[model samples]
Target chain A: MADKVLMKGNQAIAEAAVQANCEFYAGYPITPQNEIPEYMSKRMYDLGRVFIQSESELAAINMVFGASAAGARAMTSSSSPGISLKQEGISYIAAAELPCVIVNMVRGGPGLGNISGAQSDYFQSTRGGGHGDYRLIVLAPSSVQEAYDLTMNAFDLADIYRNPVMILGDGYLGQMIEPLELKEYKKPANLPAKDWALTGCKGRKPHVVKTLYLIPPELLIKHNIHLQEKYGRIKKEFCLYEEAETKDAELIIVAYGIAARVCKGAVLKARKEGIKVGLLRPITLWPFPEKIISDLADKAKRFLVVEMSMGQMVDDVRLAVNGKKPVEFFGNAGGWMPSSDMILDKIKELKL
Target chain B: MAAIGTAEIVHAVNRGENLTFIFVNNAVYGMTGGQMAPTTMLGQKTTTTPYGRETKEAGYPLRVSEMLATLDGACYIERCAVNNAANVIKTKKAIKKAFQNQIDKKGFSIVEVLSQCPTNWGVTPIKSNEYIEKEMMKIFPLGVLKDKGN
Candidate 1:
């Protein structure tokens, strides 16, 4: 058994990244996630790793792009506003197919939102925050334990998929303190060699990484098709979810990240009162666990979608359920958390 | 390499220890079908600025090496024109020195080359070279902006 140590959520993710053998980390300081860059700043130098507190989020993401192009596990993290600034760079990384981990500890806002926890960036992270037909593998962590585990796994997943993978968390998920069972950093399953990396072309042909394919429009379309095929494969193979007491329930609640954590409590409370309720938590937000939701739609009479936003993931839930079941939404915004009472109230509001 | 914002370049110059940057300046957005760039000369006519850029409208061309030379971490900052045969030799020497500085681990260095963009400037290649030797040289003079070793 690995020794357990209590640590801040943000600090745990930073430590987990370090354990993942992250060769490079570049980030600009942003709220709730500042501890990540701070922890990396202190430890990376001693550990012979590269850490740069970049001038801005844009610069940080591009630096990660350059490092990742040179064949290293690189990462950059920011909050909502900072992540917004990194969108252009993220698009470039996606266009070039550079593998890197991007962490966004979501805080409130459409613009310059406050530095409190919020899940308002669900669509931003899942539905191509940047321009173009792109998809990032988005992971939602409900606890500090998942934060550590996901941060570590994010590096591997980023490499395996050769695309950016995001750890979509809120401020609370990054600030909460909890004991975590440390796992040894293992290399990702079936990570291919980065032979296409820009390694100076010393022994092979020079590798060029760019999004500009202008001489022939057809070439750009072909590149886009290639990327789309990869995304399709990801959708088919990399969907993950966790079901709690959903086997025999007639009514189910769907939530993710911290909302799920709080909603689970509400589901248990509803069960004790003889209300048939269960919870479905989607770990991977991009490949939104539609299979389970659609399958449960066959048995469950109603679905209550919970979020810390203005009804973002519910669109996907509705798409998955395909009108077979009544899909309802309960939202909270402006850094307000969805409490158990609120979720329970919403369940009762469904009147099933 | 054709057109880049100065923000990222400034940070890279000041923060990165051993990186050699070759900044090719053609005074216009050459790759983007000759749109006006931040480094377009005061009176240069780009596609975006069809009436010839005005001081009130477009400001002035940025001397990138001079701006970067202000940073303490910038080891070498040279602006050379590659217009004529003799100038080409000097420009090559400057580029070699920039790369050598990185290998020597001296510090960050950038060699801003005043090259010609014939297609974007809507001129013959020969005429573009002459433009670099004449118009471009006045706004962006060929000289070393900063050198830590010297």
Candidate 2:
């Protein structure tokens, strides 16, 4: 095993990004996710990388856009409300097909609800939080170690697709402390070169990175078609999830991020009590492991979708199940998290 | 280019980023049919402000360069007009200086060019230039508001 270091979730994500050779970072200070920018400011400064504590969330996302266009790996992060402010820029980055990482350490929301961890941004992250027909490769990490690992991989995923990748976390995941192995950084093999990046037109024609496609309505439609094709390829090639004892279980719990961690414990208790319950945790929220859930729906008698938000991921679960079996929901919101006993009680109530 | 992003301007100035902002102030919205913009002159009439912009109703015109000049991080801020040949030359010089400041790694620089929107202002192009020289200049004075390098 590599040398293990105890670290907070946010700091691990920051350190992982730095290790991934992320050269530019710009962000505004928002609760729950503030440690990411705070850590990046110091680490990036020492490494002589560009780090701007930008004036606003809007400015931060735009700065990330400029840096990414200049062929540097750039990143920005914010909490729920701040992420809302960044949607317009995110849409532009998506339309331009610029690769960048955006971490949304989701807090309780609707509007400045609280600074605690919550999974309410699931729909927003998966359904293209911005205004457009686009999607972000959303990765949800359930633990501090997964947070570090996923954040490290997020940069490569962003580059691979020429699309923005989102690290969707809740406040608890952002603030949690756990032991993490500091793995050696290895650049993935045969990653595509950024030929589209704007590195100044020296001995070549200029490359214009813009989202605007005016004149001739077909031009915009053509661009949209290209984006949709890329998304289809991603959906087919990359769909990740974790399954635990799902083979013979009659009841399954579908969850992700912190909610999945709690359900893991509940699943164990249900098993100990001689009840057949299992867990399916989706790691990639956008390229959501729908096929696996659909396949499991045939075997399992029923499923329970749990989240820290008020029934957001449940919609995705229901869509994946598609009436093959009954899908129930267990959720809490506004900084409250479900306990294992609470989930066990729900399982018993379902008479599984 | 437009005053709709005033918050972004404030943010950039505060960070002292080595960037140039070319602010083209046409006083009124040109697209989606003319409407009053932040830089619209007091008592100016537009599609939205058909009764002429009243101080009580519309507030004062935003002097963006002056507002940004107050930030310590702003290295240079100048407002110019391209209404005539001599002023056009001056506007070009100011723009070059702003870019030069960026190359020299001097912090935030902005050059506000008070322009004319003839179509939106309901006037001929030549008449719009005259309005910029005769009326617009009275509210948005053309000169260097701040120059930290000098």
Candidate 3:
């Protein structure tokens, strides 16, 4: 094991992205997530990699689009409002089926709400955050270590699927500091070469990366059907989550990201008081751990979902439980965070 | 050229990115059925402007080359026309120069070409060429607006 070093979560993500061999980075400044682009600017330059403090979030994502099309592992980072601006380009990238990583250190928002940790972007991120039927593999990291590890793995997953991957963090997760063991990034075995990338054709036929399929009306339909099949495979193969003390528990609290950390603390307090409570922390927000939750539904008496938004993930939780068990929710939005005591109080109210 | 992506033009120039932008100015929204565009000339008739375009309703024509020329990061900026064979050759040369500037890492280079759009302009193709030489050239002059590389 390597020696542990203390670092901020945002810096951990940036450094891990560098270790993942991200060749290009472009971003516009936004609060809570600015440290990522700031660190990437200096590090990428020193390493003689391409870095651009793009004109806007739109430009930044478009730059990522261009680099990914040209067979470079590219990345971009932003917050809520900035992420909204990149949606158009994100849709284009998804339609083109290019591989890249996008980081969203979420802050409060209906619009520029405030710069504080919030999980309000869950619906936006998991549901494709753009004008398309495509999906991004979204990873939610609760701790600095997980932030580092997941960011590194995100690149491999992107390349393997030839799709976009999103590292979904919050303001607290981005700014929080913790000791993390910096693991050396080893490339995963057998990632397919980006043969479809638009490098200029010398002898081989030219490859075109475009979204318009207007020749036959069914052309777009066929493309969309292919995309849906890819998504179905990802859903079947990749679903990551952590189960803590759930065996023979009466209440299982489902949570992710910063909210999950709080739930963990609450679950500990409940256990100390002789309450049979457990925690289910989802790491992958999309292709969400639906099967485990559905299986847990058989044993657990009820499930409580905690979040920093007004009950977004709870919908998925309900779908998974499917009336087999009672599913409940507790959440806040637009810059308010949940505490352990508040979550514990909510747990007690359930009378488990 | 459309008014969209104008912010990026200035942003890329300011960053001194080694990129080439070929701006085509046809004076109307050709694909969308002859609507008013930012570069639409004064008194030009389009779908949006049923009568002659008035200054109160629309604004003066935007000279993109002249606007970008003032930026210090711009290594080259030129406006040319492809109305005639000789002018077409000049436009090609301008485009080639812009790409060469990018290759030399000279910074942002742009070549704005005044093109003909007979469908949107409601004129014959020959009349469209004449329109570029006569009316469009008056607003968008043919020359190098900025050329630090030169």
**Interface root-mean-square deviation, candidate 2:** 17.4
Tell me the tens digit of each residue's lDDT in model 3 across B64-117.
778888889889999999999999999999999999998888889989999998
DockQ of each: 0.02, 0.02, 0.02
CAPRI tier for the interface of model 3: incorrect
True interface contacts reproduced, per candidate: 0.00, 0.00, 0.00
| Candidate 1 residue-wise lDDT at B4 | 32
Order the candidate numbers by lDDT, best to worst. 3, 2, 1
Flag regions of model 1 displaced more than 4 Å. B1-150
Instruction: Report, for every candidate in turn, its global Cα lDDT versus the true structure.
Output: 0.86, 0.89, 0.90
DockQ, candidate 1, vs. native dimer: 0.02
Backbone clashes in model 1: 0
TM-score for each prediction?
0.71, 0.72, 0.72
What is model 2's DockQ versus the real complex? 0.02
Off by over 4 Å in 3: B1-150
Residue-level lDDT for A47 in candidate 1: 87
